[model samples]
Target chain A: MGRLKSRQAGKKFLAVTGLFAMGVMLLLPIFVALPALAGGAPAAGGPPPDVVAAQEAEGVEGEEVKVEIGRDVYYKTEGPAVGAPAPKTADTEEFYPRYNFESRVLLWVANQQHLYYGSFVLAVPIFCMCIEFAGLVSKDKAMAKKYDQLAYDFVKISLTAYSLTAILGGILIFTFLTLYPAFFGYLSSIFRPVMHIYALMFVAESGTLYIYYYGWDKMKDGLLKWLHCSMSVVLNVIGTVLMFLANSWIGFMMSPAGVDEQGRYLGNIWHVIHTALWNPLNVHRILGNMAFGGGVVAAYAAYRFLSAKNDEERAHFDWMGYIAMSLGVAFLIPLPFAGYWLMREVYAYRQQMGITLMGGLLAWLFIIQATMIGILFLTTNYYLWQALGRMTGGERFQRYIKYFVFILVVGLLVFITPHTIVMTPAELKAMGGQQHPVLGNYGVMSAKNGGINAIIMTTIASFIWYQRGNRVPAVKWAKFGNIFLITFFVVAHLNNIWVACYGYFIPANVRIGLSVPQVAGTLSCLFFGSALNLAMLSKSRELGPIRWGQIAPRSQYALIMLATAFTWMMGLMGYIRSSVRLFWHVNEIMRDNSPWAYTHTIGFGANVISFNVLFFWITILFVFWLGALGAKKAPVPATQPVPGAAPQPATGH
Target chain B: MQTALYLIISIVISVAYFQFIDWALMDMQGLDYFYILR
Candidate 1:
């Protein structure tokens, strides 16, 4: 009996030891990772033995070294001068070795995928805010309920994508550390404080997002709904700040300011964070993100619409698709102007860089970008046209589509026209010059501007046509209003064309300024013309109720195409922007000595971008599927309006 | 003189486009009215 008891005691002791070992194995990583998360510093104890031995081996002793434990500080130079080459010391010559393939390509894929998810998560909450507010103020109870349900759906879709964004971000950081460790180390050291702020903001954003999403049903009534919407506003603010902080890092890389030629950090952290290109990049990226988010949401709605089992489901998804598309297109309209501003800033910062981007090595990439833009605008117009089939009197406007199509096609042709062709030596000699006799004229910025502006105006006109579908203005000044709109558009077109023509006769310095007035003319038409139309349709007569689920299935495919085009264009532009800083780690400050520092061929770059686009789409589609699975299990609440049962007149006009 | 001519042409085109839209809307409304009356 004593022997049996001893055996049991031994077994018990063994079990306790195993449990202790397992617990330590699991909890050790949390303990190690916690210090890294807290300002990315080392633990309370001194440096690890291996790190100390490596530092000693590298002769990194007694040099006033700032021992950044978790973060790697690649540069050990003491206050390097601006515009001067960094000292080629053992400490500064940090090696970034790629295993098999090019490290930069891997970095590009990770960065683009991370950006795609980040933009999606950042953009959807703003849409949710606007939609929820609309629901709050809407007098139509049924419509309000529908809007609330839609807003809830948007947040639900974004939630899964948000987790994926964090995962992709972690992947991106790992890629940077593994692939371009030296560059990342230097960048992190300079923006350490901002990184801390960014981490804190991320935590706040996570808390707010969770609270806002979970508190939706609980705060569905009167004052609580308002409070819930206010939470979205808070969430978006944190998100926007986070985006700005991230942009500062990229902007500093593009246009390094506040540091001397040696790539030294100037005393002011704010100065380092707020580089010359910071605000412009911020504005451009924000607008682009909004448009991209809208496209993604619209594509999601389209997918749902296609899979909807009943007419009620179809109607709900249809209306949701329209709303998301409108939001997407609205931001898309102003996106080009923001892009123009960004380009102008790039030119102002460095004319040589701008030339390389627009007129030199990257020019062909711009041609491809133009094709993508043309596809985007064309697809948008096509979707709008297909949407008209849902309206009662929409057939009347169908005849006008051919004219719009003609203009859009011509514009696209001109916009994508290349200044030069890839020809054989003999063919080049035969052609006499790089410029095609006829098509070359259209390839210049002068003609391209005219083409794109025309496309924009035509798109605006299409929107107007869609707005007028199924409705007749009952206002007394309707005729006058129509005449005013016609005249305004004509003048806007004249001004745009005149500016384009005028650019050819002037010096480039003056010609660049002319885009300002050209953009202003388009804005006036969009703002004033839209305002006039709204007033005219304030109490419009409906021809018939719109059949929400009547649009063609092909239109949904167009939305997916739009999102894909957007993703591809973003990747291409990012490649161009980054490649412009050729052979330099931080523009002119630090030279890149890596073997793979040179820009890839256009074909290779295109393939990489396409691959990134494909990967992002595949992953995002999975995220959407996961979201749909959760949605499928949840029964539609009684408070939500039944779609298609009460067909309301289109109020978007 | 040339610029004025171009401007006039643009205005005329714009007006014509507007006129087409107005005509189409009227025609549709007329068809709807007849359908209801009949």
Candidate 2:
């Protein structure tokens, strides 16, 4: 034991030393530039030291030297405008290559494909990090081994997808340069420093990921395992910073900053990167990527489960699917809030852009988005219900599922209803207005907000039931706890609807504030309801062990549906965001005179998104096949079913 | 009697929680939550 303690101390020292080395590597470029920046200027608002020295050496007077200074657009500081204005490109072969196909379409397909693979690769590492950590912390020996294997499986799949991501990224950059050289040149020039850092960070991420994956077996013991897990943290940090740098370019295009009216870059790189929409976009995209990654992983597990040769394989894949779905749903729950914050920031940046997104030409796409969101939640609930069948005591909660169905349907209908419809003259005259007399009432944000929150609340309740499926509360305050939870959800649902109705009666300004309380009500149920349920179940008795592989085949289909829908939604939303810039290449900064500047019809956009989703699934299925092929030689996991002693996977919280 | 008491207490607590959240969030945005009552 003393030897073990001393060895542990030695590992701690090594770990600290390793961490210090990584920190220096991460900040090395910045540190290298510090001396140069310090030696640049001799005094405030004076000529640079190099310029003064050159003048003195040439026998020129100090007063003869005049340095031109420009003010930073966002930071409001004085500095040299080192970058040029955005190029004005004409509709010619020089500016846009005249292929038989549309350049915009080609670029769109490339960008979408790259983004899909990129989000997947980034998201899988995060899952590996979390699951690996869970393994390290778990007290159960067999469960720890299972978790470790699961995390390894996740990384193995990502290793294949990572190469595809890099290939697609290369294709996207080449497409940009070939089709839209002028625009690409300007964007790259303005983000020169940021681009260099992004490239370096990408390289760093690649090195770390390779080491993390390859060193897994050698580092699977003692403090080495802990060090291996920490490496994932470093991997994620580099990945996130890389994503942020990419987001800055798009954010600048949507709402340019740190540049003058003529599009001259200001000296402060931070001002350029930290545009108005940067923070919200970063938050939304991260959550979105995580949820998307979860869906893809779940679908992979489902595919494996459906084709398993034995009960052992089936049980292993079932548990894996559940864990992936839980991680995905965990991110999905807060995704809408992040999206809301993004939309709010868009409105804050430019109200016209927000109007374009929610109320104008792009409004139909939002309806599609709403439908997708509703489908995601519904599928999640359905999977949970099917999952409950594996538990002996789950039947007690089965009766409540139909009521949940009714509530969900009602919420979905209200959420998807359009405020206004495009109608011909005669049709409009027949209806007396653009909105329907009865259904139109449900179209407004107030009602839609209530509808979504209701759906979310029902999902939360479904999750709670799934958690308590095989357990009977044994706490002294079980009855009171049950009563409180029921009362809270009831009131919360009613309050959400009441707030929605109240909005119609009040002034518009005050009505807008109603959404805050409505969202709060849903979140309250999530936190308080779950807390109360867990407390009641703290000393619960299990009715029977969870039969992991006993779920219906239809549940796997639900997982596939969730993943496909997530992919389609990501594609549609990306198109909507890019289209909101309209004819401009960079909002008010740069204009695009391309032939395909106009927005495509909703049908066309939908078709393109569907194609992208289909293509992604086909390729990903191939990747999954490759993973399965390797599984023959892979070490067997400790997840084999042991009669009535199967381990319980963590619930989606 | 015990069930009734529990019901009453639950209603009071839930209502208070929602009301506080509403008022505080609204005030944070510089909006008056009690505009209707006023």
Best by DockQ: 2
Off by over 4 Å in 1: A1-94, A420-440, A637-653, B1-38
RMSD of 1: 14.6
What interface RMSD do all candidates show, one decimal each?
18.3, 0.9
| Tens digit per residue, CA lDDT, model 2, A1-653 | 99999988987788777767777766886887676568673222223469657868766553554435676555567766556877888998888775798888899999999999999999999999999998899887777878898999999999999999999999999999998999999998888778888888889888999999999997887767877888999899888888999999999999988877778875667678889999999999999999999999999999999999888888888888998998898899988988988998898888999988998889989999999999999999999999999999999988888899999999999999887666799998998887778866768988899999999999989988888889999999888888899999999998888888888877878888888888888988888777778888889999988898889999999999999999999999999999999999999889999999999999988898899999999999999999988988766664543334433333344
Q: Tens digit of lDDT per residue, candidate 1, span A1-653?
A: 99999976775665466445545644665797686667577422233479667768667556553532221122222332322224332222266757677778888888999999999999999999989998899888888888888899999989999999999899999998887777777777777778888999899899989989998887686555666777787789889989999999888878886566666664445556667788989998998998899999988889999999987788778888888888888888888888888888888888898888888788899999899889989999999899889888888888878988998888788788887556788987887877667656667777788788889888887788788778888998676667667777876776667667867766665555566556656666677667777788887988887788788999989988898899899989889988998988787766777777788999999999999989988898898898889877987764555443222222221
| Steric clash pairs (candidate 1) | A81-A261, A81-A262, A82-A260, A82-A261, A82-A262, A83-A261, A84-A261
Model 2: TM-score, first chain: 0.92
The alpha-carbon deviation from the true structure for residue A440 of candidate 2, after best TM-score superposition, in angstroms, is: 4.9
> Ten residues in a row with the worst lDDT in model 2 chain A?
A642-651
lDDT of 1 at A550: 82
Residue A181 miss distance in model 2 (angstroms) = 0.3
